[model samples]
Target: MELTDTINQVVNLTKDEKLSIEKYFTVKTLPKGGLWIKEGQYCNHIAFIKKGICRIFYNDQDGNEISCFFMPENNFISSYTSFLTLTPTKENIEAVEDLEMLVINREDLEKLSKEVPKVQIWRRVIAENLFILLERRISMLQSKTAQERYENLIKENGDILLKVPLQYTASFLGVTPQHLSRLRKNSVK
Candidate 1:
C-alpha cells in the first residue's frame, strides 16, 4: 500500500492533510539486523514501516537482549518516550528483516502540528493508541501466566510467528525459550 494510504488508515486524514504529511516523510531502507536507533541516543525520528519487521529491544542487567515489541508492516515504530521528551532512549530499535520505512523527524512533526491543526489531532490519536497498547501489555505481564500469555499472543498476533524469530518472540512474551517451546507443544496437543 502507498504511504499516504497507510497514514490515512492510521489517522483518517483527508486528501489535503495527507499531502501535508507527505511533505514531512522521507523514505528509507534498512538491512536485516540494522540498528535504527540505539539505547542512550536521542531518537529524532519516528518510522512507519512499509515492509518487513522491526524489533524494539534493550540489553538487560545480565547483558541479555530482551525484546520489547515488534513493528510489522503499516505499523509505527519509535522510542516514543525519548522522542517526546528529547531524552536518551532506553530502548533500541532494529530491523528484523530488510525494511522499507517512511521516517519523519521530530522537528518536522512539530512544525507540521503547528501549521496544520489536524496534525495535532493525528498525534493525539497515535498517542492514545500507544497508551492503550501499553496498558494492555502491562496488564498481561502483571496477571497472565506464561501459557496464557503465549496463547493470547497467538490469538492476537498469529502472523508474528512468521515475522519474528522464535527466540525474540519468547523474549517479548517475557518467558524463556524453553518455556515457550513447551507452551507451543502443549497448545498443539
Candidate 2:
C-alpha cells in the first residue's frame, strides 16, 4: 500500500501535495512482539500500518497490563498524548504480529503541512476520527454492560477472533478473562 493510497482514503489531496507528502514517509517492518515505543520515551513518529497488527497498552499500579487499543492493517498508530505534547509516553506500542508500516517524523509532518496545504486537511481528518473513536470507547465503557460490550465488539470487529488473543481482548473490554470467556460462550449459544 502506497502513501498516496492511504492518504486518499482519509482525505482528498492534489497530486503535487501527495507527492510531497510521500517524500516524508519511511517504510519499516517490525517483528512480532517488538516494542516500538516504551513507557517514558517520546514517540517521535506516527506509524501507518500496512500489514499485521499492533497494540497500545499501559501498565497499571498493580503491574498488570491494560490493553487500550489495537491497530490493525490500514490503521494509524501513535501515542497521541505524548506525540502532541512532546512528553514521555505513558503507554507502550508493541507489534502483535510481524508488521509493515509507513512512518513520518513529527517534524517532517509539520513541514509537509506547511509546504502542502492539503496535508493539513488530512491531519484534521485523522484527528477527528481519533477523537470520535475515543469518545465512543468511553461511552461504551460507561454505559454498556460487560455482555453488551462483548457483543458490540463481536458485531464491530468480528475478525478480532482471528487477529487478537482472547486474554488481550478481555483486557481491552475491561473484563476478566473468565468473564470474557463466559460472555463468548453465552453469545455463541
Candidate 3:
C-alpha cells in the first residue's frame, strides 16, 4: 500500500518497526459530502488517502468558499499548519467522494516517533512535501495565466474534471465557472 511504501521509502523502517507502527494507525471512512475537519477545529489526525478525493477549502473575506487544495488517492493529507501548531484549522476538509483512509493521530505519532526515531524523518519528509505542494500552487497563481493553470491541472489530474464538481475546479483554477466552461469546451475542440 502507498502508506507503507511511502514511509518505507522515506525512513527505511525496519520490519519490526513497520509492524509496531501499524498499531498507531486506524482505517477510517467518510461518505461523499462528509466533513473530516471543519474550519476552526483542531486537526489531530493525518490521513493517507487510500481511495477518494478530499477538498481543502476556506471561506474568503467575501464569505465565499474558495477551493484551495485537493488531495487525491495515494497521498497524505492534513491541515498541516494547524496540525503542526495544534491550533484551529482555517480550512475545512471534506470528502469529494466516499473515502477510505489510514489515519494516525498526532499523539500516537509522537509515541511512535519515540519508539522509532525514523518516524521523525518521515514526518519531516511529509511536511516538506506539503510545503512543496503549497509553493507550487502559489507559484501558479502568482505567475501563470488561467489557461496555463487549467492546462497544468489537466496534465496533472484530468480525471478530476469527471470526478469533482466544475464549480470547485473553477475556484481551484482561480477562474469563474463560466471561464472554466469555456476552457473545458475549448479543450474538447
Tell me how candidate 2 scores on lDDT: 0.88
| lDDT winner | 3
The 0-to-1 C-alpha lDDT of every candidate, in the order given, reads: 0.88, 0.88, 0.90
For residues 1-189, what per-residue lDDT tens digits would candidate 2 score against the true structure?
A: 666888888677778877888788899999998999999999889988988899889999998889988888888888888888999999999988999999999989889889987778788888899999999999999999999999998898888557888888999999999999899899998
Worst 10 residues of 3 by lDDT: 1-10
> 1-189, model 3: which lDDT tens digit per residue?
667777898888778988878888899999999999999999999998999999999999998889998888988889989998989999999999999999999889889899999898988898888788889999999999888899889999888767999989999998999999898787777
Clashes of each: 0, 0, 0
Best by TM-score: 3
Instruction: Give lDDT tens digits, candidate 1, residues 44-159.
Output: 99888999999999999998899888878988889999999989999999999999999999889889888667777667888999999989989999999998999998998889
TM-score of every prediction relative to native: 0.94, 0.95, 0.95
- Among all windows of ten consecutive residues in candidate 2, which has the lowest summed lDDT? 1-10
Superposition error at 86 for model 2 (Å): 0.9
Better of 1 and 3 by lDDT: 3
